[model samples]
Target: MSTTSPRRLHLNVNILHSGFVPSAWRLAHADPRAFVDVAHYVRVAQIAEAAKFDAVFLADNASIADQIDFRPITALEPTVLLASIAAATSHIGVIGTASTSYNEPYNIARRFATLDHVSGGRAGWNVVTTADLGSARNFGRDAVPVHAERYACADEFTSVVKALWNSWEDDAFVGDKTAGRFIDTSKVHPIEHRGEWFSVAGALNLPRSPQGHPVLIQAGGSADGRDLAARHAEAVFSASQSFDESASYARDLKSRAAAYGRGPNAIRVLPGLTTIIGATEADALRRRDELIDLIPWSYSLTRLAGTLGVPADTLKLDERLPDNLPLPGGGNGNHTFFHATLAQARTHGYTARQLIRALAGGGGHRVIVGTPEQIADDIEHWFNGGAADGFNLMPDALPDGLQDFVDGVVPILRRRGLFRSDYDGSTLREHFGLQRPVNPHARMETPVVAA
Candidate 1:
């Protein structure tokens, strides 16, 4: 082993519609019905592990949206998919998205803890607030809650989850055969959390997870979102279209973290990335055009309208966006993607057709098209250039696209010492080199309000 620790690169494969390309499913080789199939997801996760990736992450939404008619949605519950993934692979970390807004803390706490145990500590929870009026409707609400209140609920929600995770001390499990004892009951405590949003009466039903608590990840970029991440989140999934914007976001978030008595390194920001791979520059361009050509113009228009909160019929493909475009009313929709898409259009002064073509299937994440070597080069440039700490890889097509990334780009990354060649530890936290979180009681001071 080298005495000097290598500069590790964290790569997470994000399973999006066979792959990240908007028309990936429409490809002749792509499976249109794969989204609901558990085995399809498991096979993808297995490929990621074989490539030595840090984890396979699944994004989620609680309700069906307008785009479901045109494209597949992530309809499976993340915990369920991750459990299946855990069974199929032993070393890869499984990260699942769960909306704090719609879920109860106690249930979430127990669910993730069980996942961690089942996966041998290779589980992580991506905390999100399902931000769409459509989701609210499914939950029997007329409208989405405001940003501030949603975050307030998230803050209280995560607190309860953490407390429940710590209810059982490390030594609480004492399976002594001779003594006929299974556990030390006194070591297990109840968390009586009565907060403005939720109340949890007591301890989690399961024992403490192998990694203490599954890693807490957050992915909102609003002001309120950053504050919550600073105080609690270990990793954050972000979206920024340009390098300058990404650096600014990274700097601002890390700087803001200091106010919470946490250091800049306390939180890691990984931006969403969609890559289209080819053998050469010309090949890459051809490949991208192929994917774009597969998208139905009507589907793109409807999706764009919903994102901009505009009526679909009013948006003409050939026309420029009307001046003084309205901001989304009600805190509905995926805020990061909502903002990023608008920013992309505004930056390039794009017409409706241009914008639709550019976004094709990315949904709002940054999209990069290049050869395999070029793809690795772009990732290295961003990682070292302060644009990101790591990337959440969204392949443009399912198994084929991901396979190309793994077989071609992974070796380049290893050769350049940008990524790992083998497993370092069993748990997701260990793979990320993060320390197990110490319980809050050990660090609690009198709660101080933001001035």
Candidate 2:
């Protein structure tokens, strides 16, 4: 909402294995084995860096959440892969998803802090709470935590990690050989925190990270999720099927952030966007149809049913979705994708088959099919309309699909002066036009000798 400076759009690519389309791995040029290939992710990151993208994001899963028999899964661990990516690319920031529901705060704090150090401050942590049954079973739990319980823990978990990050003041490390002092002990403070979900006595193991705290990102659409994002997230990955929905979400989130004593611009709302590009509208339509057609009707129907929390048997390809669908897992499963997918179906009154095609054989996120000019125009309209700060792009396919976007749409955005053409700073914070947080502990304890 601040008008002192020209608004700049931010972009991050969700390196979703082969692509957003489920059948993208079937593409002739795509490597079917790319899901676990480190080189593949590195290649995508390098291309994004070339396009001057703000970051390349990776979504994580503790267990194989997808139907891996028919498709590739998110196989590699995020932070480790991101470290490899950071080694391969210089400018593009690396953001990785880690679930707060399962992880202890200290380890996450240490892991990302190390990434920021090695990447020269180009790291972000996307905090998510695991919601699926497989992940729960893998973690030795019989059932997924209730929606409120998971978010409550996540809120506390994030706060504890932040406190640990702030435990050491910026000037805590001092290598004064003459003074025989390797550290300014007084500058390091312990956060003696005891809370319902976590307890830690601490100063972090490492010095303050390059960006103070690596950029905090969150993704969720439920009320608890929104409150968590408003309370702690620096940026959010969102799912809304339409521009008006995205605008409404943005306003609500910013309002919540304001209520928490944060500035309206404190949190960036980035909706999930899937693009299927071609030389023209007809060409793009052909490609979308081709990809969707590759997917078996069974797979799309099953996926849709899962998101809607309905039995796959209940879905008929030619029939419209059943009315009065309940929230997945008794209101505890993923709310973002569920709502987004349902909104798309209801808004268009699409049958199961139509819904599947609209979503490109997968579930959730908005899909755009067209030429570079059209994609650029849509992105412009959303950004200029305050519908989104930008998008977390999931192209129809990877490396190749991203190449199309960078080579095509990026130039148009650059021409309009809506996005950056080159890296202006080494840190992710600088890339996003965000400021490094001042350590509250440092500020509070700075002695004021009477002037």
Candidate 3:
């Protein structure tokens, strides 16, 4: 779309506990403790790295957002867990989520900068604003911050983090024995930032990270979210359900980025895709049915109700969704997921039961059940048709589902020249074809003249 060839496809695996499905833990091969075990995550990372995938992503929540009795929750602290993952895998990127709603800018800046150095530049931060009241309670608040206020805080929070990242020049470090110097004091400056949400007056203790600031990623789909991504995000992980929907979203997002003086190529829009692969289309469908059948109707209905912001009893399993359902929490509660769910139900006129099956694996991402060729075709269609740059793949089950994709689907994609056969670069930025950002302060000074 930005005069760049749209031939290469970038992919990342979203390591969702056992897998994306609620019943994934029930699978014969699934380790019930995979959610908490470091070995489980490291194994998944190794698989993705072996496949030459761009990255392996870890999504986080400050509070339990799902019914944990039935499914394993995201239990580990992401940055800490990803540090172990970084050590286990050498090429794949390690990206983890952290919320701006509850963290101070300085702490987040230092944490991610440390991750970048630890991972040899194969680190990324998924910026999110915690939206659930459960998380608010954990932070000693009675209610979640209003949507606008949260975004405002996030806007300022990200700005301060960037400023802190830029506080030290690239060559600020100088370890010289003869000169007896460790750092060039003149090359580092305190940020001295003051904003609505936070105020700080100091440079970061850490030097510039390997990838400048570790690729900034955002996942909100509201207008405010789009604006934030337009202004700051290098890549967006979106929840889009259809080709038309994703294409439109991509167009609108790029336009907004252009309005902010960023190039169309500057922001990559990768929609979420959940794949249930098998030897044939029918086998794939059977696998989908097996997973859906394992989930209790009560759990499914309750999950759907939560997304729709309605009581569980209000929904009838056999009936279509209520006409003109109101936006969840008056458009404040999980807006992206809410809209995506509604679109899927309304577009297909799916009954409640059908809708649950459709979303059983991915929440609201596009779900495809097919053989390797069919799955490859779906990915190619989206990539070439401008619906997505690539995808953040959520396999229906962990290691096994991912293995099926890598052994079956990935080879087809590679044979078609749509994906890489091997890693060409070591850093995540290089994997995504993005430039390592230059420090803004480095270009501001002119050489002093000796008269």
Candidate 4:
């Protein structure tokens, strides 16, 4: 194995239904029942773990989100599902999405802390300010909060959550059976947070997690989104359709983080990548075409319309896109994808139909259809060419696709000295080469008392 100084590639499987393909469930051998089956999810998580993947991510929504009637919805709540996944797997990191817009800081803190403890520090939370207006009605509001307001609330929300995580110092818990003392009461304090959006009493009910706090992750590529990520996120999940866009995004994110008094390397900017792998290039292309064919043209057109803020009826399959469409009114929605799609369309002079085909499977995320070697080449090129630090892998199909990666691409990466063959540590922090967070009270240093 070749030893490298910059370290190996980090791969995380984004478990979105069967995979990144919109019609993944429609595949002949695909299990329709797997959508709700805990065992099916566990099986996929195991596959990812066997590949020594850094994490298994689950994107979530607050309420009945999107076209739930037609699409396969996110059925299980993320935390609960991650907990089940934690029980089934030992080492793979469990990352779950939670919306800052709908959840309170205290609840989020407790849920993630509990996950970390259960997973032995293999936990991460993908912090998001939810976008859909449907979620608002469920939360007793008629409309979703404006973009800036949601992020403003998120900033304070995350701060309070971190404070709560630090409520009990690392050494606070002592299982002293003889003295009948369970925990050091002096070491625990309430956060007493009173912010514009939320107020919460301090002191998380759970003890400090194995990693102190589960890794904080953020997604969304708007200006406010980037700002929030710079201040608090350890990882930022992004979507870009091309190397040029991904590289630009990486440069901007790192620079923004540096300006925030954090090291540029503090955050890992991983763009989502969906792969359609096959033994040969032609085979992969055929597989990709099959999935694309299954997508309803009407469904695809409607989605593109919503994302581009253009009327669906106005766009023609072969007609070139019009210049300068209006942006989403609330400054939200998938802005990253919006910009990326526009850039792609303008760069290639693609007709509306071509744009739909390109983005049909994975939205604006990069989609690759090739042999394992070809896929590896693309990943290496992106890593070395400044497009990304790592990649969020969304396979075209689950179980089988992941297996192909573990069995095929992983060995190629290992041979090229681009990935680790064996795990180096237990915690996600160790896996990511990040330092363990020091306890807040440790820096304060009260004198230790012996009981």
Worst 10 residues of 2 by lDDT: 439-448
lDDT digits (tens) for residues 28-94 of candidate 1: 8778989988989999999999988889999888788747666788888999889999999999999
Report lDDT (Cα) of residue 25, candidate 2. Answer: 95
| Clash count, one per candidate | 4, 0, 0, 2
Q: In angstroms, how far off is 412's CA in candidate 3?
A: 1.0
Give per-residue CA lDDT, model 3, range 381-448, as digits (tens).
99989999889999999989999999999999988889998878899998898988888889566879
TM-score of each: 0.94, 0.97, 0.97, 0.95
| Between candidates 3 and 4, the lDDT winner | 3
Cα displacement (angstroms), candidate 3, residue 162, comes to 0.8
- Superpose all Cα atoms of candidate 1 onto the true structure and report the RMSD in Å to 1 decimal: 4.7
Q: Candidate 2 lDDT (Cα, whole model)?
A: 0.93
User: What stretches of model 4 exceed 4 Å from their correct place?
Assistant: 1-5, 443-451
Is 1 or 2 the stronger prediction by TM-score?
Answer: 2
Computed on alpha carbons, the lDDT of every model, listed in order, comes to: 0.85, 0.93, 0.91, 0.85
lDDT of 4 by residue, 1-451 (tens): 8674566689999988777787788889888767788888899999888888899999988777545555677788989999999999889999999999888888999999999999999999899987777788889898878888989998999988889989999888999999999999888988888879888987999888999899999998889999999999999899887888789888888899999899867988889988888899999888888988987877777777767767889778789888777666545665777887787788888898888777654467777888999999999999888898789998888777788888889899889888888789998887777778777776464889999
In angstroms, the error of model 3 at 32 is 0.6
